[model samples]
Target: MGRQEKVTTSLAGTVGEEIGAFLAPVDAALERDYPGDPGTRQPVHTVYVPGDVFGAGTVRSWGDRALAALDEHAPDAAAFAAVLGLDGALAEAVYARVRTKLEREPVEDLRVDFEDGYGSRPDAEEDAAAARAARLIAQAYEDGTAAPYMGIRMKCLEAAVRDRGIRTLDVFLSGLAEAGGLPDGLVLTLPKVTYPEQVTAMVRLLEAFEKARGLAPGRIGFEIQIETSQAVLAADGTATVARLIRAAEGRATGLHYGTFDYSACLGVSAAHQASDHPAADHAKAVMQVAAAGTGVRLSDGSTNVLPVGPTGQVHDAWRLHYGLTRRALARAYYQGWDMHPGHLPTRYAAVFAFYREGFERTAARLARYVHRVGGDVMDEPATAKALSGHLLRGLDCGALDLAEVTGATGLTRAELDGLATPRRGGGAT
Candidate 1:
């Protein structure tokens, strides 16, 4: 035989020290179907309210108001379903379910903002608001309607506003502790983060609060808001999402994008600033890439085009919100901010329809792939993950039942349960 050329690859040249350590955990995370806590139910949208009007009963009140508005504005599920391109029969089912879901529990997460939502206020007023918020927290727990996820959004740590932000946070935390300590699933949101030091400082402050308030260590976590060009890219043109999260020192649970503010940073005009804007897409893409397997959640910004004002515009606005919500879903951005109560209907509609419209078809395909059936069908690990993701997401959010998923996927209950989980230590099926 003729002599063959020798082929050798240099591992060090291919992957440096940093890449190796990063990949180690990433590979382990990928072995599972989903990263982070699968039991953690990520709300479809976060409802933001100003600080003054926020009280323990606020969420319940909002649910009632939202339901009333939904009935008046979007009474028929069939109509909204048509707007989303859902099948007539399936659309009705989703509509009916969503109506009940909203009536029962409308807000999954609430943010009492001391930032733009509340605007500037006197210290006494701010303190009063904080106390009210604390009472609300306690009330929510007692009533059993407290959202599974809830938090307060303080103003940025900028020099001018940092003191007020700190004061508000301190007052709120103190009141919350005095009332009944921090509740489960509570987080503090730090917005417009431009430097890693901001995160480090906030973490230190939280630690101090935990100690003073007699709360468990690390009981409070914060979500970073990526709203500036600086957040998307450092001065050296490197992505800063991972750095920002690391600066949190293990307390950063989620990173949320702010659409209008981010767009303004890019100098995009008001008319051009949108959820699907190129600049917004690029920034969020950087966030997704950096935070991919780290288990730090990512949320897209809100759509400012609200469904209020005129009768004609309301319908147009609803359709626009759904389109934007669907756009986020397509990019795997499951969570976004809903600025208005009206946005709630479209948010749930888009999410339910996304999972429901193709539930049976996707499940059947997955079943075929899992069973190794051949009929011009092809599947990969990613395909399995996608199918499992929908089923699990639906289940977690109350959109799909175990029976429905099992029946559709043709898998036993045990196998069905594991569908959403990453198939670890097993050969590819």
Candidate 2:
């Protein structure tokens, strides 16, 4: 008998009874199969402007002046559109004006300006301020025509906000809920996440808010900014990340690599270092490995330094800035923040390169694995040893166009199918 028949006959008696019982439940599951159609994948780049960008202070003033200048210089909608289209030198000028205005406001003022003076909701004014802040955030979403995935960096939940008690957490979440339904796929940037319990507390608060709103449980998501030494130095960094992921459970969507905070944690003195500093890269690798296949996106923190001057090789400066940005993107992380419009192209290019390379590499490896192994299993350890070479070869070549690679390599559909299937051994067959 052939191998298939031999195996079937060996299981024909007692095993057949177990198989029949298993098949009985199988039909019920098959009948209710809800094989949903695959949805289109959205583009991954998200440009973040500080939430304070539109509050009633220097940021708001700068925005008003910039808008007025745009109106005066380019009155028509087309001119307005042209200004929006500005990048490199022209874009830098507009961004600088806005940045200057935003920087003028003391960080203390911005923090205190939040409704209710941190934790205490003394009266109606605080409530009104909270409502206004929420409205401004919503309006910014509408005005900027921001990417579908938007997030805000809020003041940390702390002793001041907590009133030296746990009630502060509830008050802040309540304020957010009262302001509006959680922003689309909310990402609360929790600064100074030192312990797992802190993450758990935030999750509990989000859960309470969702239940009260009658929203689906776990609808809100969060991303932690890993800025503290304690966060990075936790016993088994991987375990720490895994713990954070579990705390948010269904709600955690991303983990942002906080370069500046991390450097400070390490006591690095150099101020001009970029996000890709060797030390930062090592920390990010830990995050990337932990987050792999979790469906939780990873983002590198922003390039803190912005280019100065309105003219003279501004594009070159932007390119250099982008080169750092691209390195982050190439590392297989999905998102990064753009502090200015000039950084937009770099973000886009890096994203395009990542997807293009990842798809091509996966495809090519599958193609070659099928060619070598055919439909049979490699049983001998010695025979199985060199099979990894095929995968490494494809990865080494970087990205390629799927159609072109398939055509050039002459791999057939049946072989491709075998390659796609997992083998008994861990590596692709």
Candidate 3:
């Protein structure tokens, strides 16, 4: 055999060390600012209930109501498939899981609204409602009937409601603390955040609560609601939404796009205002970029064209909701807002179908990537990670079964998770 050629270097080793030293801060910044997805179960939807109306049975009641909607309108898998134009192969899987999901766990994330959905209540009334919400939610968690995540959407940080928002937040958190400490899935949302200062204020407020309550620092995290035109673009023409995420100081869990309020801000007529609007798309696109790799999830807003009224109207509304949910999923916005109980049937239907339809193709691609084999579509590490992530999300939202993903991909849960997780500095090793 011929001797291996000796490697040669033109530069000294010190040159490499100097380059590393120069880029150390940049590396640290990337690590700090863009930590990637938290690898937690990001819920498919967040259901908002007015504070005055939310009760202990809200979760179960919503489930039952959604199931009833299905029983009335969809009736069966074939009916729903026809309504949403779902492929025949996906009908049974989507239908059975939607039914099972509604029966078992309908609302994955619940937000007790003290903001728009709640409107303005008298100070005393609002205070009592906040406390009541905390008590009820804590009890629900204790009873094992709680959604995976629960919290309040407090009023904005505007001058008129600044004090009210803070007071409500304190009352809710204090109430939970007094009841039996915070639950594992506790969430808080600071709504209508138009400036980075608002985010910093929330961080400070949470810090104060931690200090006062003797809790660990940074134990409380909250979502920043992006619902204003100013939040998407600033006076100086920079992306303020990105600044908002940074201002959260590592405590922001998600960025929720608000449909109605944001549309109204831009003078988008009510008739034309919807989650699929061009204005909403532009704003969410900015949000998607701002939140990318920040470990902050993005949630598309809800639609006011709710599924209600007569059978014909309900069917139309269901189709719209299902299409919107599926559209958001395609755009990589994994979570969304659901305002009406009637919307639940279609929400699950869309999510389940998306996962089911792509199951075979995605599985084959991942298998080929793992085995280093040839296929029509060449898959790389990033593509494999995305494939695994899609499967995990499907499993998380009950859209796809674990046994099926593993059986098809020939990959274990741990292996899938490792691929789904983003490695430092990204790209293939």
Best by TM-score: 3
> Candidate 1 or 2, higher TM-score?
1
Q: List the residue pairs that clash in candidate 2.
A: none
The 10-residue segment of model 2 with minimum total lDDT is 34-43
Model number with the top lDDT = 3
Model 3, clash count? Answer: 0
Q: The CA-based lDDT of model 1 is what?
A: 0.81
Q: How far does residue 418 in candidate 1 sit from its true spot (Å)?
A: 4.6
Better of 1 and 3 by lDDT: 3
Model 3 root mean square deviation, Cα atoms: 1.2
TM-scores of the candidates in the order shown: 0.87, 0.58, 0.98
lDDT of 1 by residue, 343-387 (tens): 887888888888887888888888887888765668776677667
lDDT tens digits, residue span 1-429, model 2? 455543334445778788879897875543323111111122243344442333534334433443443334444434322433433433443343333332331110111123112434454544454455555545544564323343444445555544322333344445556665566633455655767787887787777777887888868767676766666557664457666765665566667776676787788776755677787887778777666545565777777555334533333444565577657655755456555444443343333344343444444444344456443343333232222222222222222333554664455433433343323344422
In TM-score terms, candidate 1 sits at 0.87
